[model samples]
Target: MQKPVIRPRRLRQSVAMRNQVRELNVHPNELVLPVFVREGISEAQEISSLPGIYQHTLDSIRGVVNEAAKAGVGGIMLFGVPAERDAVGSGATDPDGILNRALRVVAEEAGDAITVQADLCLDEFTDHGHCGVLDSRGRVDNDATLERYTEMAVVQAESGAQIIGMSGMMDGQIAAARDALDDAGHDDAVLLAYSAKYASAFYGPFREAVDSQLQGDRRTYQMDPANRREGILEARLDIEEGADIVMVKPAMSYLDVLADVSAESQVPVWAYQVSGEYAMIQAAALNGWIDRERAIAESIVSIRRAGADAVLTYFATEYAQALRAF
Candidate 1:
């Protein structure tokens, strides 16, 4: 009743004014596309839940990568699904392993036009579906897993991956991988740490994408969602341990953590709008409940507005193309 002194609505009166005053802008380079590549397949297999996305074989993966680059996507996050699973996930580090092979394939296709990142977790490798070796009690062996991650980081880096996404969520994974990369003379290779990755149901689709055989949950390693302070702590530890970038998984659901990490991080803070989030929007759109393109833009815009420097998303290529048109 104080004569509406502020009059903030005046700036919202026009589309041009709103556009000019927009604070967080999602750019093509700020988006990273997550791709799934599988072995022992000759063609792309469509994913039911994730429409328009496919599980690509090597021959087909190249084309997808080229499309991503042409659409102005900043990078690709590679996940591998092997034809077989083993007790130790032995295939993960083999030079010709599914993930490493896909890395090489994508790198060659992109050819310096895009950043190629490989997932450095062993869940897709081990038959047990744990990130590392298991103990007698069937619990994850964290130290042993760190060792495996170290080996994987180098294998992925040598395979032409520009960045290693250390997603194991092990206590010392970032430091271990950093040392392994530098000692192997891959000093230029960077680490994109999954700093605040939480054990969330959002990863259900990712398991299918990677053909993971995980027998149990990852509560022992991945962060608990109830602990907000731990998110910042994890990000800080990764940064101190030589991570080039730190990320918060399932971006929209963890905006608080993303904001905290972004405000505190000296390095780039990335967020992942993971599989479940994508599925939710897709389902709503399919049912005619929401506009797909507008919803996608809003979802990513919210992440950027929360202070994330970049976002990893399955919708990256689509959104990047849409952004250009906008």
Candidate 2:
């Protein structure tokens, strides 16, 4: 064979060499675990669609938070499944509600060890399973939903949520949440805006994870997957509204959106490796289609490379442990 003038494989010679040449790395602190707490359940129930994920009881949530803290995971993003749902999602603003209670428990159990974030959306509490309240016309009431989110923010702050994740796609949600938190004297509480969330088919598993009661699609509010510029605009609006961090959901499918937001956003940009993404990898791995461990590491690393300051993932603890081992 003729001698090659240049050999690019020189850098791929060994594990240490690859590590040295790697430009992006996923640290334990860059992974945030997404957890669910369900009301009226004594034991944790496995989410069939999400495989290893579960709808945890209050006690189980505490245990999971403790484990995440011990694993050196960055944070836990909490979602609550209420025993009852209402038209206005009254449970969301109830301090005694499942989510708020879970927040208090996790904060008390692992506050100092890890960041505790609360999902500030009302989907799990609303009978309609929409992120906001509905109008008499049966459409999502944008302004009315903002009012609910404002109230929800205050309760979440009081319950010890270090960060409030505004997952609702309401027009003025970030501004409303920030104002409410400040008025309630939670000036230090961070707001993580789900700025560029898309109406994706990839959220099927998450619907099951949170026991979502969504009746119709969120396409009216959420960004269209085909529109890249709209995602950038959403992030800009959230940042202008005082969001401490902004996120793009379904990280793998929206990496371009994530990267664009990260570039434009002055604040930290995070990404969510949503339930369907996790389930897909798990299903493939279980069927012997790929290396489970390697797939997990690569997925998050790819998100990191795409400009996520942190990634909320179902594999957070596992990925953190794997990083520690490396």
Q: How close is candidate 1 to the true structure, as a TM-score?
A: 0.97
Q: Can you give the lDDT of residue 284 in candidate 2?
A: 99
Each model's C-alpha lDDT? 0.89, 0.92
- How close is each model in CA RMSD to the real structure? 1.2, 1.1
Best by lDDT: 2
Backbone Cα, N, C clashes tallied per candidate? 2, 0
Superposed by TM-score, candidate 1 places the C-alpha of residue 152 at a distance from the truth, in angstroms, of 0.7
lDDT of 1 at 228: 88
lDDT of 1 by residue, 135-204 (tens): 7888888898888888888889999998999988999898898899999999999899999999999988
